[model samples]
Target: MIDWARLQGVYGPAHDVPTLLQAAGNGAKEAWDELWIQLWHQGNTCDAGIAALPALASLAQHTNRAVRFPAIELAGEIVGAGLREGRPLEKMKELHQPVAMLSALADGWLSERPAGYRVCFRAKLALDGFPVLSDVLDDFLDFCCDVSCPQCSDKVSIVIGDFGCYSSIRDWNLGDVHPIPLRPAAPDDLQDAAQGLHHAAIRDEQPRLAWGLRHVFGDAECGTCDTAFSVLSALEAKRSPSTEFQENAGAATAPAGHDEGKNRHWPAPPF
Candidate 1:
């Protein structure tokens, strides 16, 4: 006895909102895509999802929080992904557009009126990444950092310059007896640090060194560092203990002619 038409009217032009809401719960790819398309094409709506954001975010605050969590997360994912995809900024002229939407979503996540601190932190990072969007960044960060959202101060921290250096700074401040040098790593050292950072980030660990490099050296080096880390991690995994054991077993069982090393003085294996 669900009134489908009434439900669609209540949600918006796209009766798909409820479907998307449900899909988010189940991790339905289609539902996610639909939601992304709506937010991405926010230009199609007069209010740009502003009116509906609050209600949608409220669902995340329910007693059964899981039911609403996905919906709330999807909201941020859509916007963040859209921006990352390099959507044309001309389509979103209002300086406060994405910021406002994101602020509301963050508010719902925090279970209170949206504090602008986290939003401003994200906005600053986003702006730092996309300088062309400077005006929007300025307005959004300003609004979010306003006095009303003082709670943001507790939630956000700023680290300036090169990801690797920043990581080093944080480590140093943490009372590490011997902190990694604060300057950019030497070319080879940078390569090694980059590799380390990549593995750390992939493993969902903090890539302090990598972050410092990115924050200091800029995107190109940061990307190189990530690539190096990925390649190194893969190589290391390929040579893991089990893999080494299998290779050694194969060598030990080789035919007589392959006994070249068997007659020589063999060094003891490290392990």
Candidate 2:
């Protein structure tokens, strides 16, 4: 039994957490909204968030689809926060079994729901202990974000949507000042976490997400200074203090006969 009163959340005490979670399990939307704000406001997880993992996992495992999906997502976010703050889940012995349970549930769900690829993939990354990459790919749907150039401190906007995958410095009055196209990694060139995620997307029939992963793990040049850098490296450097993903770029150069021509026609179910 958890003494919620002794633990702290974003608020002073976590006494209300149990009640909120109970309400959430019963499909109370307000309870979910309040719990999200209190336990994980703006991606910052609290002690209460960690303490509530088992309950969240139980809800995710037994509840109806409406509650299960968000429950798992919230649990994943909470787990990811530990790593983002330089605390890997491996060190938190209390959470090991709960995380393992969630991972097993997610693995089973992924095979049945290819349409929920992004959400499922994020949970997979979190369960696999990659907080930074999971967080960066959270915006995979939007397919755009601004990263300050480490070389010249210029704001470079990266676009990885249907229009194309490329980096550019945008001027509101001028538009796409010096656009540089992204060099997507070939399937064989993707390494480690990138390769795993791409393969999962492809296997799950999320071709669009799989294609985007190539660019995400590929290389790009700074639009302003022409300095070449790994796109994944630049993105990782900008998001968190972790440089662990730098090695996820695979080989430095794309192989001689890489082809992106087969990267079209996304037939996955729409979210």
Candidate 3:
């Protein structure tokens, strides 16, 4: 039993998750829109979405193609995709999760659930069509969010706008705002995390994230801007994955520009 309360969605505590999911199953338009906002957030990733994926994946058999495809794509991206360059493909495989999930999504609807050991792919599931969009670098670069750096994600519009330190990005940036009093792992903890966040923005082109860091940058008293920049500079000092992503950037999760947030919402099924 997963503790849904422990997770955070783009808007608030992941309220209405089960309900929204149910509504999605029923082909509710508002449900799909909210789901997209909660899961991807203007094209950026959301941890809440990642956590719920295993649950959402079950809806693969849903009659609504929008529901099925988005669920598959979102879940697939987290298990090893989205930002495309994420460590999941290697990380989850090392942990062992995708195959079964994919197998189920691919064939679960066709027949009885495969046995515990017999859950082989009756047919290969191709993720190519779902293209995870978080890998693009320029998407995170520029923004109109000179107002703030995302300290809180209070949606001032139909969807969330770029407000730093105020929102979430489940699968996009390096510096996450979860756990309130955020901390680092080890070694170059702050720097590495900072670098990772900045690099993800610049490298992935997650402009909202990029500008969020810029928001943090403007907070001189916080001293995070200089720190993040120093980390970025050091990262630049040494050629690494950031370079690789830059040289061969792929699809952007969000569109580039001010407050555009790379808006991507699922369309309703045609009657």
**Tens digits of per-residue lDDT for model 1 on 1-271?**
3333333221256555656656655656676566656543431322333333444455544455444444454444333433444545335555345445544444334333234333333332332232212112221110111001122211111122211111111121332111122233333444433443333333432244234333333211111121112212222223232223223221111111223344522222221
Candidate 2 residue 263 C-alpha distance from true site, Å? 20
lDDT of each: 0.33, 0.72, 0.39
lDDT tens per residue, model 3, 1-271: 6567777776778766777888887767798778777766543455566666656657765676666655655554444333332435334442235435653464433233333211111121123111221222233322111111122322110011222222222223432223111111232333533444444335543345444344332221112221212212222223233234344333222322223334523221121
Tens digits of per-residue lDDT for model 2, 149-227: 7788887777666435667777665655556778889999877756766777777777777777787788777888987
Ranking by TM-score: 2, 3, 1
lDDT of 1 at 142: 9
Candidate 1, poorest ten consecutive residues by summed lDDT? 140-149
Top TM-score: which candidate number? Answer: 2
* TM per prediction: 0.28, 0.70, 0.36
Candidate 1's C-alpha runs over 4 A off are 1-14, 19-55, 58-63, 88-101, 104-271
RMSD of 1: 19.0
Error of 1 at 190 (Å): 24
- How far residue 180's Cα lies from its native spot in candidate 2, in Å, is 2.4
